[model samples]
Structures are given as structure tokens and as C-alpha cells.
Target chain A: MANPVWMVLRGVCRGLHLTGYFCAFGTALFGALFGQPPGLRRMGWGGFGVALLAGAAWFWLQTADFASASSPSAVLAALPLVAGYTRFGWLTLARMGVLLLAMLCAQKRCWKLAAVLSGIGVLGQAWLGHGAAMGGGKGWLLFGCSLAHIGAAAAWLGTLPALALGLRLSQNPRALAENYSRLGLVCVGAILATAFLQYLFLIGRVSAFFTTAYGAAALAKLLMFSVLLALAAHNRNRLTPALPASRAALGRAVAWEIGLGMAVLLAAGVLMQFAPPAMAMASMGS
Target chain B: MRRSLFAGAAMVMLAIAPAAFAHAYLTTSKPSAGTTVRLDTSSIRLSFTEAVQPEFCAVTVVDGMGTHAETGKPEAVPGHDDELTVPVHFQMAGKYIVTWHALSVDTHKTHGTYSFIVGN
Candidate 1:
């Protein structure tokens, strides 16, 4: 069958990633305020969860190759649904989810119960993620980087939705600002660290930057990162200290930062789909 | 609670320290993995959706009987990234296997083997 043109366009452009962005923002918004109060945090999280489940279901319903749409909850349900599928789709998701849960739970200070359960989840993903192409020590690198990327993104971007909810609730202005400043710095740091690691993998040679495909992608990502850095500098060096004339303004700047962060993550979703240039394994004298 | 958060941060740092560097994978192959193709096979191609560590990728046609390689290293042609091909000039059609090992853009290495028969 001829592949659907729409799916092809969406696949390359990462239209699903757009939904993933909103869903991630939703998850972060709700998760941040999970125990805090009433309103959207309550309704939005529920609504978002339903939206996610429905999206997952809808994705699965459209799929024809999966033997059957056996379970709506199976992450692989999207395999038959997404255009130009990756062989390791379900495996990749399981790997990312498992490792993410493990990292989340292994905290020496986290709830023992949560840690234990998440630890179990990690094991499950390993069983599923095992593939000749992806696993072992290197897989750990992929898992860790992917988690940091997503976590930092959620913390950074999700804050916007949270801030909006906060404004609606009329929470203490001082409390919100203080919390955001502290948390935002942390998120920025996390994002920076992950980007550094990714850079180490990509920056093979100075000349390659202009000559290589990998280099070009890296350069594009760098340009985007630079813009964010400039915006962040404005927020931290100038706007932040001013007390922003209004708390709402503080929230808006954060929303802008979060929006940029989402764009970065969008590139990330596509980039991750590609392989590392380091492993290009130039077929020398084969 | 704060302590747990800090601890979570620490564990993540340790776990991610290693993986943030992973590369790409070779994913799939043609010639019906394990099946044999003749020496005249126009192209022996390996495809990876991501940019690869060209320095590390190998597309060698190894003679099953002689244990000799059939070609110099294959190269990624300009423009097409999804596939990299090596033209094989088989001295003669014999049983052969294409063994490959590659490092992906994220720097993760993946290796695999596929066989094809070259015969009248």
C-alpha cells in the first residue's frame, strides 16, 4: 500500500510531537499541583489524562498491522498507527518509560513505596527494550539523556500551565514567584547539563560542523538553544529582579520560556529518531 | 520531602551520566536476512534514519569460503541519509554474508549480519 502522504508529512514534521508537547505540558501542570488545591489542577489533570488515553486509543484504532488492537493501553498500539514506523517503537517507549521510572524512584529520599514500584517498572522496560540495535551500557546513556531531556522539559514548560492555574486561583504572589525562581533555575541547569552531554557526542571535528549532516542538525539545535539562553538571560539578569510590575507578567515570561523549551523538545523528538554520528562507523576498507 | 527531591536529583545524575550520549541503530535489512544473493547483486545497502559515525560503519561482503572481503569500505553518497550502499564486484558468486557494525549519531554502536547466496 502507498504510504499516506499526510502521515509522511506529519512524521517528518513531528505533528504527533505537537500533541506530545501539549500532553507533556498537561502532565507537568497537573503533577505540580497534584496535591495542592482545587480547580483545573483537579479538572485539567483528569481531562488531560482522558485526552491522553483517548489519543492513545484513537491512534491504535487506526492501526491495521498490529495483529489486532489488543489493548488500548499498550504503548505499541501506535505502531500500526504512526506513519513509517520504527521497528522498536514499543520497545523504545518501554525503555524510556522504564528507565525514567527507575531514575525517579531510586532517589535515596523518595517514598520507599514509589521507588520500589518504579524500580519494578524499570525492569519491565528492560525486558521489553532489549534489542540488538538498542540496549546495554549505551542504552543507559540513551535512557538517562532522554529522561533528563523530558524531565527538564516538563519542569520548564509545564510551569507555564501551572503558573496560569496559580494566577486563576489567586495564590500568594510572593510564594509563586519564589517557587518559580528556585525551580526554574534548577530546570535550566538540568536542560544545560543534558545539552552539554548531547554536544559531547555530536562535536566530532570543527570542520565537520559545516560539512556533516550530523553537524548541521547540531548547529540548528545550538541556534535554538542560544535564543533560549538570551531570553533566559533577560528574565534572570533584568526582568526577574524587577519584581515584574505584576505577578502575571512573571507568569507570562515563564510561559514564553516554556514555549521555547517545547520547541527544543520538538527538535529533540525528531533528532532522537536519528542515529548518532559518532556511530556512523565509516565503512573504512570493508 | 526536600531531601527525597535532592536524592532523586542525585540518582538521576548518576543514571543519566552514561546514557545522554547514546547514538543510533541499523534497524532493518533487505535480501531477506539469512537468504543469499548472487555476486551480481547491483547494490548492497545499509540504511539508518539518523546520521551515522561514518568513521565506524562497515558494509563488507565477506566470502564465506575464503574468509576474504570483497570490497573496500562503502561510502554514504551525498543527499541520501536513510540508506548507505556499497557496490559489490563479486569475484565469483559464492556463499557470502554481509557483516556490519556501526555507531549511531548518539554514539551507540549496533552490529548485525545478513547472508546472501551468489550462484548460477
Candidate 2:
């Protein structure tokens, strides 16, 4: 078993990396879908910087974990081996490259192109996950599900900050709210659908949900997601119709959604550290 | 539209099989865990649940006297991406321990140790 402290540290780094990537992706996507909002450029740049730094930290930590390296020199020696040889290493390097390209696009104010690159970076995450363990058609299907799951999640959660800014800046808050509400609905549907598929593939049994660390973290994430849904619903149903009059309330709700979304992302990061119950059972049985 | 999308996702989910395993884990060994083996056994072989990177994997065999019995580095078995083998030359082993650390092709790490008695 890995040390608890190191595991937590890795999870935190993973969460930060996801948060940063999602922020950049979301900002670009928002601009593409609903026109660029004021203050988004700074947010996008900040997100890119954070993602780059956190991604480097995540790679370093993963190298140490994989090699069981206790010293800096040992980790340094193992870095080349991991970065050059393993699938995870290759994907991480590729993702960093994509992120860099996305940053360049964002700098040039090519929102649509930036969004595409960042979205691909998000999709590439599927390869680093449990979906990559299996081979053949089933593996491909699982990867598809993972791609949808992450993309929907990034689209919805990542866009919240930009949406908040849009709400603040748009003279016609109602139009902006309606457009986002539609996108939010589609993202939510995709999230739920892919989440169900992932549960079947990863969890398999309800009992394992109670028995495993992965399950507990997943449950925590689900709870946070539920809160986010409620907030979205409140915004879409009650707040949007009364937009100008209820902008403050809607803003508070979006802020809450953002906080809860971050929590969910962090839980997801920690959850990936544990073997999914189905996988664990299969290993033990074999 | 949302309903159609959900229905489509449901159909896809029902069509797919659940994933069997993730991360490489030792499933079985040539000598087998906690079993008695003949001293003539020439190598230690480990079979994992998932394909592992052989170049990044390590396997060591040590006798009860704490002397290394393994002759060379672990190597992938021909046509078996999920298996690793290391040649061993046990001079006179009473009890031998085998420890292995594997990096799954997906880059997850796992390790374990097992012991077997080497008899006449």
C-alpha cells in the first residue's frame, strides 16, 4: 500500500491540475458558444499557468510513486524511464503539449480553436484512467464513455466561472441564461449517462460501494454533484426567468455550484487512486 | 432530444460488458505461493491480470540465507505480454522468497512478495 500522506498529496495535485485545465477549457468554450465576456482573458491565462505548474507536479509525484523513490536523485533517475517508456508518461507529455498549444490559441483570442485543443486534452485523460487497462473493443467503448464523462463534466463545471462573468456583463442576462441553461441540460444528461456506464464497468456491485475506498470517494463526489444539480436547477427554473431582478441570487447559486464542482473534482482525483471494486475483485478472484 | 440521447446511452451500456480488471496484479506464479517446489526449478515466472511493461518491472529471488538466487533481470515471456520470468539458480534452497514490482502498461504500479519451500 502507498503511504496515506503521499496518496493525499498526489490526489490534491491531480485535483488542482484538473481544476486548472477545466477552467481554461471552460473559458474558451464559453467564449466560442456565447461571445467573449469581459475578464475572461485573465481567467484563461491564469488557468493555463496553474494547469502547467500542477501538471508538472503531478508527473513528478507519479514518477516517485511508480519507482518507489524516496530521494530526489532516485526520482530524477526514474523520471526519464517513466516519461519515455510508459503509456501514462507518454499521455502526460502529450497533454502538456496540447495544453501549450491551447494556451497559444487563447493568447491569440482564437476561442474556438483553443476550446478544441483543451477539449482534446481533457479527452486524453481517459487513457490515464481504468479504461486504459482493458484492450480491444470493450476498452474502446469504456474509453468513449470516459471521454463523454470528462467532457461533459469539464463543459458544465468549467463553464461556471465564465457563465458567472457573462451574467455580470451581459445587458440581456435572460438571453445568456437561456443559452447556458440549454447547454447545461445537455451536459447534465451526458454526465449522468456516462456516469452510469462507468459505475457498471468500475463498481459492478452495490456491496462493493460500501466496502471500497473508491466507492466512498465516489459517493462523496456524487453527493457534491447532486448539490450542483440542485443549484443549476434553481438557477434555470427560478432564477433565470427573473434574471435582472434576481441576478444576485443567481450569482450566489453559480458560485456555490463552482465550489461544489471543485469538491467533486477533488473527490474524483482521490477516487482514482484506489482500485475500483470490480477491478479489485477480479484481481483477487484471478 | 434528451430522452433520445438517454435511450441511446442505455442501449450502448447494455451492449457492453463490464471491465474485468485494472492495474497489473500477480495472479499466479510458476512455483505458486506457499507451495513446495523441486530444487530443479530453473526460473520464477509471474502472471499478471493485465499487461505490464517488462522493461520497468523487477523480480528478485532470495534464499533463506538472504543470498540472491536470481541470475538476471526479469524478462517478458514470448507472446505473453502479461507474464514475466527471471532465471534462478538455487544452489541449496530451504526456503526462497520471490518479490516482484510491476508497472502495468497503463502505468499503474503494484508489487508483492511470496515464498515457497525448495525441497530435495
Candidate 3:
């Protein structure tokens, strides 16, 4: 799709926004359940701040997109109208409120409450993407899947830094790894299952997987995920058992997984920006 | 070098942020966006930059006096995937406002309003 630069801004906004929320939720949720690492705590607070700022920018950018206006003045002029009237605008407002609460929670060191607020922020995100377009029962179902997908992903990718922190602190790093490994496996399973469900809802046809922009982005994400899985398996079976001796290697692998996860997220952001294959095929037919 | 690379990436994202979006746009409209039109007009037609769902699309034409000029549901023009036609009961000479909400087949929602004088 040949879009005006505003959409690109929106995409970037969405990318940053999601990244912030994921990091905030993951760090807080893990910190609350496990030992709160000082580094992860700082990161969670920073991520929450970023999400709030990015979300505001995204709202302005969307206002510009809706008004089909380009200049800063135009965006400002349209901002009130879009924010006041549209469902998206209202959702953005709600998200902002949730984020504010999350920040307060973080400040109070109420990691559990902060995590819950972050989860609310993440769950509400489904309405801004392709799932929002789904109507009737299917839309609701897809939305549920999207929520599950995001929650699982946060639990997995979001907690890696915390895990790294744990590895660094715990004397019995092997025991820590074994415990987290079990939880990580469950998180991965949920991520995969929910992702597949979302794909089925969005793609609607196998051929679309090859022919559409969304399909191509999804394929790229899948490839990245496959590599991530391989790296994870190596860490779980090989490096993890080695414990403190292999701490550096395990840390490096975790860092690599985080990088790949970010790549996957970027692909996801791209996918949301394009029409799914079903829509593309329908457009072609029309 | 790593810090510079991160900064460069941030710069690129910011520079390219406002350049692309996949949402549909109001490409054209009958009587145009802001112009005077004769009272004899029987319908309003809008063209979008993308194909839209006819069932989910809506259009309303109201005069300055708060009287509804729209007479029926908006429809996709046959053979014209991007165009929507709405029947209107336009007769009085006054400013008419056309508000349209469309759901593009790609699931992007776009809406806008345009006003035109119905009398010379």
C-alpha cells in the first residue's frame, strides 16, 4: 500500500508502544513473582514511561492520518476531533489512564499491581489492530486469541532480562534455570497456540501466506521464531545445565533471543500496517 | 559504534515515520468537496483510494437547517469498487454536509465530512 508518511510514523509509534508495554509487563510480572532485580525494576519503570509517550505521539499521528493532513498544525487541529469522537481515540484515552496508574504502581513498588495495569494496557491493544476489524463472534474470538498471544509473549520474551538477572544473582543458578525453564516452556506453548489461532482468523486461506504483504511479514516472523526456538533449546538442554560455568554463553544466547524477539515484533508491527491476504485476495477479485 | 548505530536507527525511524499508512482515503466526491451545486442533485457519490465494505459503510447528508437529505443506504457502485453512492433528497437551497464512514476491505476505518452549498 502506498501510504502517506503519517502511517509510517504511526507504525513506528505502535512498535515503540508495544515494545514498551511488553517490557513493562514482563519485568513487573516476573519481579513480583520472583526476586525483584534492581535492573529489571528500573527497566520496567522506563518502559512504562516510553509506552505513555509513544502512545500520545501515535494518537496525534493517527489524527493526522484520519484528517488526511500533513503539517504539525493540521495534526494538532485534527487531534481533538479524532480523540473526542472515534472509538480508537477513546481506547487511547483509556490506555493512557491505565499507563498512568501503572506508573504510580511502579513508583510505589507494587509490582503485582503494576503488572496487572500493564496487562490491561496490552489486552486493550487488540482493538487497535486487525482484530478490531473482526465482527460478530469471530471478532470476539480473535480478540481473545490476540490477548492470549500478547500475554504469553510478554511472559516469555519480557521476562528474559529478569531471568538473566536471576542467573547473575542466584548461587544455585542451575536450580533457578530449571524452574524458569519449566515456566518458559509453558509460555512458549501458549504463544505458539495463540499465534496459530490469530493467523487462522486473519489469513483465512493458505495461499494468502505466499501472496500478501501481511502473509510475507508473518512468514518472516515465523522464521525468526524458528531460530529463536533453536537457540532456546540449545540454552535449555546444553548451556543451562552447565550453570555458572556457562553463564556468559547462556547470557549471550538470551541476549540474542531478545534481539530476535524484537525483530519478530517489528515484523508484527509491519503486518498490522498492511492488509491481510484475505482482504488482498478479495480486493483482487473485486 | 553500537551507540551511534542505535542513534542512527532512531533517526531513521523518526525520519520515515510520517511517510506511509495503509488506510483508505476519500479520493473524490460528487459535487466535489467544497463547491456550489444546483438543487436538482438527486444523489451523492464518493470515491475512496481503496475498496470498502458496502455493508459496513455509511453516509449521511444533512442541510444547515438540520434536515436530512439522505434517502437510503449507501451502496458500492457496480464495477467501481472504490465508489459509494448514496441517494439524497436534496431540494432546498442551503449548505449541505456529507459525512461518510467507511470500512475498507483491508479493515481500516476512515471517516470525514465535507460541506457544499446547494444553491448558487
Ranking of models by TM-score: 2, 3, 1
TM-score of the A chain in candidate 2: the value is 0.95
Against the true structure, candidate 1 reaches a TM-score of: 0.52
Candidate 3 lDDT, tens digit per residue, A61-173?
A: 76665666778898788677666656677787888788768767876888889888877887787766544444435555666777788778878887777787777777787
| Model with the higher lDDT, candidate 1 or 3 | 3
lDDT of 3 by residue, B1-120 (tens): 999997787566444322112345676788786689888888888877556667557888999889999999998799886789998877689888888888664446667888888984
The true-versus-predicted C-alpha distance at residue A206 of model 2, in Å, is: 2.9
Model 2 Cα shift for residue A116 (angstroms): 1.3
State the interface C-alpha RMSD of candidate 1. 10.9
**TM-score of predicted structure 2:** 0.86
Give me the runs in candidate 3 sitting further than 4 Å from their true place. A1-6, A280-286, B1-87, B91-107, B110-120
Identify the runs in model 1 with alpha carbons over 4 angstroms from their true place. Answer: A1-39, A42-138, A206-214, A282-286, B1-120
Fnat of each prediction?
0.02, 0.44, 0.01
Ranking the candidates on lDDT from highest down gives 2, 3, 1
* DockQ preference between candidates 1 and 2, better one: 2
Tens digits of per-residue lDDT for model 1, A1-286? 0134422332233323333434334433334433233453343334234334533443343332222224545536445433233333343344335434433432322334333433343223222111223444655564565466555555555445555566445546455555666766887788778666555444434565576554665666677767877876776666556653555566676677666655664454344334444443423212
Per-residue lDDT over B27-48 for candidate 2, one digit per residue giving the tens place of the 0 to 100 score: 8888887789888889988988
Candidate 3, DockQ score (0 to 1): 0.05
lDDT of 3 at A203: 66
In terms of DockQ, which candidate is strongest?
Answer: 2
